[model samples]
Target: MKLVNIHTLIFILLFIIIGLNTAQAQVWSLQQCIDTAQVHNKNLQMNRNNISIGEQKEKEAKANLIPKITVNADYKYFSNLPYQLMPLSTFNPTAPVGQYKEAQFGVPHNINANLQLSMSLYNPQVYGAIQTTKIASELTELQYLKTEEQIFFEISNLYYNAQILHNQLAFIDSNLINAERLLKNMQLLNEQLLAKGTDVSKVKLQIAQLTNQKESISSKYEQVLNALKFAMGVSIEQKTQIDPNIQFKRANEYTSSTILDIRIIKTQNRLLSSELSTLNKSRFFPSLNIIGIYGTTGFGYDKQPNDFLKFFPIGFAGIQLSYPLFNGTVTQRKINQKQFELQNSELQFGLLTEQNNMQVENAKLQRMVAKKAVETTTEQIELAKTIYEQTVLQQKQGTASLTDVLLADNALREAQQTYLSAVIDYLKADLELKKLTGNISTTK
Candidate 1:
């Protein structure tokens, strides 16, 4: 039985270890990173929360049309009864017309309780507020979409940067291998006194330099990964890996008349216009409200407590009408101020449109330049590789010098690096173009 128990424990431990390894091996693709960021990013979540608040405000505006009910209760005790004046001629015929008598009346304690209900029957302001809140809600939704687009762009850029660094590291590794092979061959030649020791030393130095570059690139790759994790709202302490396969391709042309920012601004302007209109209508039109109250009043005297308290029921309902006749031209001045705001909104929209056009044009030009650079560098790398290979063969045949081989190798490395840079630039420019044209959100 003890042996069986030990075996079971071992199996459990093995299972747990395997599970941890699997968890740590999880990899995220570009799409997954963007999707995760949309859900987990703090700023996006806050913007979504604002949409919820806007929805609540809309509900509140609708609720204003419903009746409101309230209950109130009060208790009062008068140490001294209130006084009243009456003409004295009622009791005495000889009393002068101006003569009067003073007397105190009413109970020493009183209690009142009431329930009141009120509702707006006809208020233009309330209607206008409903419209305004609806537009505001739409604006919140647009804001969230805008934030989502921004996150997508940011994640794409970070992913591209990481892939570029990975490519650079691979390039360095390949060069290092070639350098080591050359160094070994030079050493063999040195043993036979056919090659100088300095040649071998130069190749060794080249290998060391490549190794240092690889280390630097590796560190940069890790930093990029950390940044990606931060953007995805993942825990920095957790081990996360991104898919290393990245491809660069030209994006389809996009032409949008309006971007997300423009839409949001227009919605804001509509809300403002609604507000101004409501203000104007309110100043000219009257508002109507219905009010009703039901309650009982109680009266009692401490000296006549045995008589008990008496209660009287009362109730009343009425409609009220209010109109703003004049307020020192305040309403007109407010309308003018709102009109100015609307004009400013329009001006801002025009300015933003011009800026967006410029961005799109600039990104297109940049992408074109980068594409050309990539093509040129790709050819350069091929030619440099051919030259390097031929130089190595000639060196073995006692024709080419060591300097020719080293220069060719360096040229090849430079070409590879230039190609990598061009690729990254093209990717960034494409992303920028997508963003400017409002295609980032729709493009996967």
Candidate 2:
């Protein structure tokens, strides 16, 4: 008995310590999760890398104007010295007009080396490319911001879902407590001969059902939390919990202005226009480059007293102008294709504006309807709880049957479900509304 008592005491202490640790675990707020994801989410990090890559591309464009220097070298040796033909008249002043002598002209070894440079004096393509990359860099930043908004949207949705599950689990726990209390009361009445055994059985069945419901809800809650943790870019093993409080208020009408999508399209249009301008320039405006080179040619021979190695110096500077006289009309084809794309993009811009306006209106109406449902369901929950309590009291007083109490419990459960549905609808509609208005990026 002494040993059993010591073990029991240790078990109780361990349970208390575990409970304390769980109670102290950090509960992440919605804003906290969003902020953490901004730094850690894999998708967002990739977009940041793309932004850096775009900046490098802009720098590369500017580098086209800088002078380029290169060194070249070559060496060759002839196994059989190459022969050359000389006029026979050089030896015998009037030999035959058709006669000739063969001679070998230089050393068997040869080498050439040079350092050359070319700098652009005026280049339409380089200047035009610089302008295009500037706009492209802006597009890259907008793309990153677009990705950020998408992350915010996903994380917010997961958190809201977790909160809904949390509330449902809370409701199940409340129902379980009520069912257990009723079971105890029915058992007492059965023993005192005031209630039949079937009454006790009904309450037991109710308690079992509530227990099953609680287990299912708890499992769903755990799954939702796991999903939330993944969205936060934290380890699935992380002990993550969302704030149980879901804050919402009726939102006012959102005004429309320039949105990110339109801005991105506008930047794209500018880039296309700049490229077309470059293409047109290529057809007419010529490019000029300043060139400079300094090098030497070497000759080497090895045999007897006349063996020698010699180097000859060479240098020159000049300007080169290039003009594209013609192609198979390829540049014209590109300009035509680009022109069509620009027109389509402009049309898409207007189409998106109209679509966004329609969605904004729809979201506003949905939120208002859900807001009304939430208000109505809240009152229904209160009334249902009151009826449930009165029915329980009546059953205990012998004025109502066990079936009446069960009916009241079912009514209470239905009201609770209706309330949850309304709240979720309101939350989802509000999220959609914020997204449509382009305010999601600015959302906290």
Candidate of highest TM-score: 1
What are the lDDT scores of the predictions, listed in order?
A: 0.90, 0.89
**Model 2 stretches with alpha carbons more than 4 Å out:** 1-24, 79-106, 303-305
Local error of candidate 2 at residue 237 (angstroms)? 1.7
lDDT of 1 at 285: 95
Residue range with the least summed lDDT across 10 consecutive positions in model 2: 250-259
Root mean square deviation (Cα) for candidate 2: 4.5
Clashing pairs in 1: none
- Residue 26 Cα positional deviation in candidate 2, in Å, after optimal superposition: 1.4
In order of listing, the candidates' clash counts read 0, 0
lDDT of 2 by residue, 1-444 (tens): 999999999999999999978876879999999999988888888999999999999999999999999999999998888898999998899798988999888898899999999999998999989999988999999988888887888888888888888888889899989999998998898899999999889888888888888888889888888877777788898778789988877766666567778788888988889998988887789999999989999999888988899999989999999998888899899989989988998998899889888988999999999999999999999999999999999998889998999999999999999998899899889888888887775568
Q: Which ten-residue region of model 1 has the weakest summed lDDT?
A: 300-309
lDDT digits (tens) for residues 1-444 of candidate 1: 999999999999999999999998998889889888988899899998999999999999999999999998999999998999978987789999999999788888899999999999999999989999999999999999888888888899999999899889889989998899899999999999999999989999999899999999999999999999899988888797777676877556877657899999899899889999999999999999999999999998777546558999989999999999999999899999999999999999999999988888999999999989988998998998999999999998999999999998999999999999999999899888888888776667
